[model samples]
Target: MSNIQAMIVNVRVDNLEASLPLYKELAGDVEVMRFPYEDMNLALVGPFLLISGPHEKHISQHATILVESLPLVVDALAKAGAEIVDEPSEVPNGTRLVARHPDGAVFEYLQPRA
Candidate 1:
């Protein structure tokens, strides 16, 4: 049996305002809530995950999410004007897509193996 559980993942960012738009597109139809934090913000997407503000300290490094389709996401992100840092790569584990937001935050989109 798999010991998997559902919870929320919080990713800290530098600018919440600028980052929310990009995250909104990725979240698709998922309902999201945003909480402003003086200098940063926290975006909650159900019980799945949350993307915080895009601050200087929070830029460059962040967490990742596993999606079912990498190619589709890549295309969508491209259309949204996201900068592709690493193209889709298929490894033994799964496929990975990397990108950087306008504020220089690195994002990893992973499609886990079966």
Candidate 2:
């Protein structure tokens, strides 16, 4: 069975609060998970991961994938010839790592805290 949990698209915004109403309306008023990471403010609004902050500090990953295990993801990515852009580390959400696939697509794999 695949360990992938959920995939979220990353949307960069200049202002999180201003960008949220549209997403919230689209998602039918789903609760937003808001938090801060480094200098960035992040909010999970439905399937969209809204990010607002300095562009330089951002990882520039195309998307975020929630996984069951970061270790397994690391091993699989390594075998698949994916470059580890960022080492596995605990973030505000959980443990995560950024990787660039062989096709040059970047993704953030996160294992949410239990």
Candidate 3:
């Protein structure tokens, strides 16, 4: 039997070029690397996605996108209609923020900046 392991993640973006900076800024140069796909005509980055081209029913189905900065992410997503699963608050000695995607997928944006 083949071992089942979770690998890779993708997000469909209406404009890949525009979203690149966000991921770049979020995950500095060292954290991410990009590959060009001309024949396929797509730019594939690391686990952080920057897919451009089209958005259809098949894409954007069920996904919970998480960002690194909890407080910043929560405020930003809330402005974009992300349902507040929980506010950005401290827990024990750390902190975390939670939110839900439109499709009901829950995401916890964590920042342990250690």
Candidate 4:
């Protein structure tokens, strides 16, 4: 069985300037890592990952799970009736796959390259 190494709860916001301070306050002393990718500013606040940008279409909250094996996890999710929204793609830190469960829950799965 593929194990989950890390789990991240993603929160999408319209105004980064307005939302950042709230997350900063909620996370307390945890350092937030700012990652700029595809015109989106992602703030990693402990277990909470905040994504904010100008794109209105991509403004929705989701979850990400770092799995040991991307292919294995994808296969398992597929068996459970999760439709793959985005194929595995190379990101800055690793490969990412997006899928939507039958219950309409969306999730992103990551397999970091060693």
Highest TM-score model number: 2
Given candidate 2, what's the lDDT at residue 110? Answer: 95
Best by lDDT: 2
Candidate 1 residue-wise lDDT, 8-102, digit = tens? 35555555566666667776777776555445556766443444544565434465666767777777787878898777887544687678877
Ten-residue stretch with the least lDDT total in model 4: 53-62
Residue 24's lDDT within candidate 4 is: 82
Estimate candidate 3's alpha-carbon lDDT, on a 0 to 1 scale: 0.52
The clash numbers for all candidates, in the given order, read: 8, 0, 0, 0
TM-score of 1: 0.45
What value does the lDDT take at residue 99 in candidate 3?
A: 70
Lowest summed-lDDT stretch of 10 residues in model 1?
A: 1-10
Candidate 4 matches the true fold with a TM-score of: 0.83
lDDT of 2: 0.91
Against the true structure, candidate 1 has what lDDT?
Answer: 0.62
- Ordered list by TM-score, greatest first: 2, 4, 1, 3
Comparing 3 and 4 on TM-score, the stronger one: 4
Instruction: Identify the superior model by lDDT, candidate 1 or candidate 2.
Output: 2
Report the poorest 10 consecutive residues by lDDT, candidate 3: 1-10
Better of 2 and 3 by TM-score: 2
Q: TM-scores for all candidates?
A: 0.45, 0.94, 0.36, 0.83
Candidate 4 error regions (>4 Å): 59-61
RMSD of 4: 2.1
Name model 1 segments beyond 4 Å from true: 1-60
Model 2 Cα displacement at 20 (Å)? 0.6
